[model samples]
Target: MKGRVIVLDHIAGREAAALLVDGKLTDLLVDDDSAPRPGAIFRAVCDRPIKGMGGMMLRLPDGETAFLRQGKGLALGQSMLVQVTGYADDGKAVPVTDRVLFKSRYAIVTPGKPGINISRAIRDDDVRDRLLACAHEAGVAEGFGLIIRSSAAEAADEDIIEDIAAMDALATAIMADADGAPEALTEGDGPHVLAWRDWVEPAKVVTDAGGFEDMDVLGQMVSLGQPRVGLDGPAFMYVEPTRALVAVDVNTGGDTSPASTLKANLAACRALPRALRLRGLGGQVVIDMAPMSKAHRREIEGALRSAFKTDTVDTALVGWTPLGHYELQRKRERLPLPAEVMEALA
Candidate 1:
């Protein structure tokens, strides 16, 4: 599978990153430094306890505050480890936990937690059993837990062991070095890096002059320009994301034939998930698909489900509404992609 093309352009003075698969926009990359994300580990100092809320306020080294449950007997100014569980928007405290986890491409490693767990996504009993046996033979140090990722189902035993061992060492290092005021011991995956890992290896990477060094091509097929990319033929889509929901409209453009329209509609379904990821479109999302018969709607839905499986964030199809509009619910943690991008631009 060919990896999607990543375009870094300056949109309204701020850097804009876009992902394109098969010449169609998949997602828009955005970043926010203020919010703590899942899988990020931090060493924080416990401030005062909130008996009413059953938690304690933690001041991070970076000056951000997070709230942790179970404050009883916890003295003030005590240093602790915390990981972001979820965002508590609406002026509420950010939820955090002491249970820290580290994830690689193939496994999730935990410190002070023993035993091995397998991802439920791996449904093959035989494969799961084999992986379990491999984990056992890994001989990982005590006080650590390893959860095999579904991506490891096709991996060799040695590779799995190596990944686990590396993760174990990383976990140990983090604990040993995590000290002092609240600070991050580890950073979450970058948007582009995570996208590449989950999707395809990039066939070509393009950027403007004096762009990010890491994304420039000397060894890779990198191009320098104004960072503009266009889709071939007549397939196109207009994506508008609101505070509460995202609306995507698919168009076949000049294609008028029945077969061509169906083809365009199917392509749009394939592109919709990618657009969602690129834009980080979470919460309720409605795709206004091209008008088609009921029989074709099933095909479009199936295509959408297949494409959605590749999304890094959790999403579900709520089925078609009475108005014949396809409804979807995606998990909301941080602000949507557009909001973050606009903030940066501002």
Candidate 2:
């Protein structure tokens, strides 16, 4: 399979990155330097307790709030280590976690958590066992756990060990500085880089000459592009995402062939997942596909799952609704792409 190509451009004075999968624009990212990306580690304080939700509101040094599920380890004004797991959307605060996870290209190091866990994407039992043994022999810190990412499926033992050691050292330092004022220890890559890297396999990165060179992109595309994209010839399908859910509607534009209708719908099915990823649409998503037979529906379902499996975020196919709408539930932890775009535009 050809690797996806990322096209970086400038739109409205902000850096925009467009993902091209098979020469098609699959995703778009607007570089908002003001946005706090996922995986940012910070020292935070417990400010308000939500008794009903079983999580407390934490105040980052920047004055942003994130919810912490476990409050027993925290006092009202005490500072502690937390990772920004997700951003706030639709009136919700950012999601913060006490369990700090350090991510590398090959592995994830979870401090204060023991045992080795492998990625579910790696299905081979023997490979799992081999990675398990590697983790065991890698000299893990006493309480830290190492998760073998799908990217690590072909990694050398030395690479895994080195990744663990580096992340563990960083974790140790963060823990040691827990008593300090609320502050950020490390910041993750921008939204485009973060999303691209999270894919199960690495993709080719590119940018335009006037794009974000400081971001260390691999290559450059011709120019900056628009966020909204229309595909499938004269017939256009409109895709828009909101904080609550993403809605995709298919427009045949007067095409009458049964084969043409099916072809367009199936193509839409293939395009929607990548588009959602590009837009950073998460949580509940629905696709309003052109009506088809049960067999074709099954085909679309399989295609949808296969396409979504490539996504780094955890996505659950909820089947179709009674009204023939397809449903998907994606885990929401960070700010949705539209939210960031709106923020940047504002």
Best by TM-score: 2
Backbone clashes per model, in order?
8, 6
TM-score for each model:
0.62, 0.76
Q: Per-residue alpha-carbon lDDT of model 2 for 1-346, expressed as tens digits? A: 2557665666556556765666555556655455566778888877878888777888876777778987765568888888876655656677778888888777788888887899998999988888887777775677888888887788788877777777778777777788767787888666455554554345676554643343322122211113344557645577776656778787666777777667777777767766666556678888888767767888888888788776667789999889988888877643443443444444
Off by over 4 Å in 2: 1-30, 70-75, 120-137, 191-234, 259-261, 292-297, 332-346
Q: C-alpha displacement of 106 in model 2, angstroms?
A: 0.8
- What is the Cα-based lDDT of residue 335 in candidate 1? 51
Worst 10 residues of 2 by lDDT: 216-225
Give residue 145's lDDT in candidate 2 (0 to 100). Answer: 80
Taking every candidate in turn, the Cα RMSD to the unseen true structure, in Å, is 6.8, 4.9
lDDT of each: 0.68, 0.69
- In angstroms, the error of model 1 at 164 is 1.6
Name the regions of candidate 1 deviating beyond 4 angstroms: 1-34, 43-80, 85-99, 111-114, 118-134, 141-143, 150-159, 172-181, 191-235, 255-265, 292-297, 332-346
Return the clash pairs for model 1, or none. Answer: 3-200, 26-274, 26-275, 27-278, 27-279, 28-278, 28-279, 61-182
